[model samples]
Target: MTLSTTDSVATAGTAASEQPRPEYPRPDLDRSARWLNLNGTWHFEAEDADSTITVPFAWETTASGVNRAWLERGVYRRELSVPMEWEGSRVVLCFGAVHHRAVVRIDGSLVGEHTGGYESFEFDVTDFVVPGILSELTVEVEAPADKRAIPHGKQRSIPRDDYDGVSFTPTSGIWQTVWLEARGRTYARAVALRGDSLTGFDVVVEAAGDTPADAVVVARVLGTGETVELRTDPTGRAAGRIEIDAPRLWSPADPHLYRVEVTVGEGESADTVIVTSGLRSIQARGEQLFLNGERLYLRGVLDQGYWPETGLTAPDADALRHDIALARDLGYTLVRKHLKYEEPIWLHEADRTGMLVWAEPACPSRFSAEAAAAFEAQLPALVERDGNHPSIVIWGLYNEEWGLDWDIPGSDARARAAEHAYETMRALDDTRPIVENSGWSHVRTDLVDWHYYEPDLAEWKRAVAAMAEGTQDEFPVRLGPDFVVDKSYYASDAFPRSGVPILNSEYGEGFTSLERAWHLRWETQELRRHDRFAGYVYTEFADVEHEAAGLLTADRRAKEWGGLVPADVNADTVIVVDLIPLRAGADILPPAEPFPLVAHVSHHGTSPATVRLHAAWLRAGAPADGQAAVAARAQPQSSTPRIAVNPFELSAGLELTVPAAPLGGRLMVWATDEEGDLVARTFIDAAEVEEPNRRGARSDG
Candidate 1:
């Protein structure tokens, strides 16, 4: 029988008599079958000493119940009884993920060992297991995160550890679901499905067996009240072209998914696995990213997969889906899963929820040729595992100057390694965007990206403005202290890449500090609340413990700035007329121009009239004469007023109307109550008022 334990297991107290912790191994690919959870009461101990540790969570984590220091290496022992029904072809022991190193043995016989903290590994246990007998399984896991030369991205080094909440927070032991799979002599090993809008999708399936059996790939597009099916060849490589005329694109608003089912084996003995996919293409047309053919904007958030209690492991499927849904609700179309790679379930939930993902490969701190290769080698496994999910649109190889020793003697060696990594990933799946390195160092790339976190908002805004003006590559000198606005500067040269798709990738860690009432004293956290409004967006959504950066609070509370920015005087908070073209004063305009612009304005907190543009005025000019300004007394009573013009003599051919101005008027129209109390306003041409000025600049003055 598989071992088991209670939901919460500790390392010190529980005896070996207790059962395994988690009973089921595979959470994603689940089938109605009898299995055992090898968690619970196991003979566990810290790496070197004889002291016992917990079964699942590492000794250091609170969930593990040990709360003791585990020095790099750890040993765990457990026993299981194999049923008589398993006296068959093959029995595989799978470990979801075992920190930095792992070795497995059954009935005192060595089976297999693996080194890698993020990926899963399995060993063939058929030979070691005695039929109809209790099999004693012992796994020795050596995960020295800080000292080890493994890809433990952001997992703090031992002893002098800082738990500021980033990625890979000492998640040791069997973090994922591990199980024994009883397979037939011939079984499907792995499969990959890649899709794009232009060329048809390809379905490649691989199996392990003595004979070559035909495999059929059947694809069904689900949406628009119909499911379209396409059949592919089972022998060798099979593909089908699904020409979608007007494909329904998947975004935060509309997350559409398609399912492709593959059947392995000849007839009755065949097994089917469903691959969910999305038919979309991401390409840089100049500097803008086009989804389908429209320019795409990525309102993204940095999702560093971490939980206060669970650390790396998610509580359940709903826990994974909750983040995606929250992001969508917060108006973010994309989530840059910063630094670390997430579980397959998170990506799957993203696919179903319609959130775009920029999947970054975990990176190491030090630079070495061999280390790069190891990273490169792990790419195929990662891509193959996550390629089918439509949510993952881009694969981020390296992040923020990690291991870029371009200044060192063998700099080109590292560059070549990076190039190889990039090319190898492209070779596997060219459908999505791949970055050799995300920021700082760049070579051949689909998009340019950078990270900045300065408290001055102006620096970030200046960078954004310069990028909007098509700046690329060059770093501008910092503006004076007076110009600095916010505390962080994470802007990149994405504007030049604007013709291609661009991304803000990272931003919004520092939010306004607000206070929540606590007892007699006021307890203040790093809560993000815009002064003009509170409880709108939020702060520390992800509990970035030390970083103090997030759109949500540590305990998942809406710390202000949570909901949609309510309507107010400002453009973000307020709503004004949707004026397409505000006609110049003297020029004979379209019938729509001379009409009174009406808007169903909404409010945030203040009344409509209270939101007014101070020193607001209207100006009108003539085509014949140069220009003229109209100074009208504030019509406090009327929300919609017809501003009569200073009639020019040329009003005869101009339909006896107002003169045109080189620039449009800045009107202060009062949207008030019956008692002339300013409730709201119509800030005439507040946004992009200079657009008309730029257009007029080209005129022969």
Candidate 2:
């Protein structure tokens, strides 16, 4: 089932294959004069045929112009011309990412080899390149279909029932930007900056080649104009601290960024690297996650970072920005980048747009000594690469024990591995919190995270109550027990009863949009009820291959089942309703009995306001013309007495009754502000009539 690139209205203007992703790949270290984009069409070869493909799009996706999986080894060939202006400087070939492993050759001479698929790699092709002549560049990629030890994330070798709901199609070969950069012989290898005690930033700069005796590191903060100068040691390492009188914090409301320039030398021979720094601190304090010492409510979504046209990569930078904007429009302050490390542009947009990110590492499917060693070896570099992003507040080590397949949740080895990963991340960078494993079997983690997918709202409420009251062991059943060991271990025994903040990282697997919205609203409300929970991340932002439980379709179209806009269902203050006399989607209602309804009005907004409740009935099987149908059938019912609501207050047990009416009609319930503006609304379809006792009891009981 291959979807065409034109199916998405978002990418209708241009053929993704013709001009896919032409933007500058790296925004943080961008140098217009020193870098060249290598993301257009490239010569490609598979076992069967030689072809051309869009450079960054995976071979299996539609935008690549070859909508077939490159399961076997493939080769990418392109001609590179070193800019005449870069004659004396070193030429570096950089690949944003290549699946599994890659061997690079320049002008038929082997240059370098890299093994990780998610991290960026570069090679110095200066020694082999003829200064003014075009050089032949070849990249041989080996992405073994059956290699379970490689960190393939959700990519499967073959389609299976297990992946039908959550996993996505496999992506192979280059799925990110390819570019060339020219640098002087002595350049700043890397720059790292972290917020220092919430008042300033600590900067570290490393020089690439042999340092001259007069080498000194100069750091300049762009906005506030603070400068710090430090002399490098013999090895070309320098560290300095820059203090700001009044630090501007980064948050979802305002993502202020300060640009920093790090220079490795002085005068005409100086090499400089640009960096964007955000002053912020993320800490887990007693049952809460704090950003800059203030408690934060993480309204987030599970972002798979997949697109219909481009598979693992966005069709272009605009597509990436669109997803982030959609998430924000849906009132999500955070996005959990599930299983995949997205392109740097996505993170940069997140930084600029005030969206917090929970960055995760791609995980392997099977566990082994080799896999563990490989994962550990890649940890430091990965952290170093992404740690500078201000939007990334959390680093997720493992997800649901993907590679730790050896009796996880019951084996000591699993615990040891998780702790080791946590410690490894801590050693590399301590700027953010680390989740040892996201879903279950947590050991030595900064946050207690879990995954639950209860489709039934009443049952979900009960389960959350059990967890909040420390009685989850009594009700043993859960949405997916395998993801977590048992309710007992998760609620009490997973970690010490310390003040660890709990998060329902994954949930709401509904088959329909209405079902998804209802489940999301109720689950979010339940999590809000328990202050111990930091927040919840809905199952997904958009549909992936075979995973239809998304607010948006695979083509980025909004589903009708979702409310008019993101805020209609995901507002900070919203009204929740429970039909006491009818169940969700209940088609049959007793003709003689008056139907009772209960409402819970939760106000998270500031100030007090009066809220009014309204109800109406419309004939069943009405036209499906969306808002027109909804508006036509909305016959106003008698309004309820105005009730004053306060911020962060819950008004429960508000009751109303619907007089018995003819069968075969829909029931609509809505709430309004004092000015009669709609706040939220819900509807139930009634298609038949039944005796009171003949109907199943409400699940809310």
lDDT of each: 0.50, 0.73
List residue ranges in candidate 1 displaced over 4 A.
1-41, 48-56, 82-90, 130-132, 145-148, 158-169, 197-201, 209-252, 267-269, 405-410, 471-500, 509-541, 562-701
10 residues in a row with least lDDT, candidate 2: 1-10
Per-candidate TM vs. native? 0.67, 0.86
Off by over 4 Å in 2: 1-19, 158-166, 210-214, 473-494, 562-566, 578-584, 587-596, 605-652, 655-701
What does the lDDT read for residue 219 in candidate 1?
Answer: 42
Cα deviation at 405, candidate 2, in Å, is: 1.7
lDDT tens per residue, model 2, 65-173: 8777745788888777766777767677888889879999886789999998888888877788866677777889988776477777888754232322356778889
Q: List model 1 lDDT by residue over 1-701, tens digit each.
A: 33433222222224234443343433233321434445555666663556444455655666666555445666777666655665544566666677777888876678988877777677767678765666778888886756323466666655422222343456666666566655444444555656665434555666544333444434444343232333333444444455455665565456776665455454544444455676667766655565665545454566777766666666544677788877766545677887667877678788777778889776765567666765776677677677877777778887654545322123666656667777888898888777767653555456655444334433544454454445543343222334332222123222233333334344342344221111000001111111110111112236554655554665455544311111221222223332332211211232323334444333332122322222233533111111211233432222343221111100011111222223444433333434544443333322222333354456566
- Look at candidate 1 and tell me the lDDT of residue 217: 38
Model 2's lDDT to the true fold?
0.73
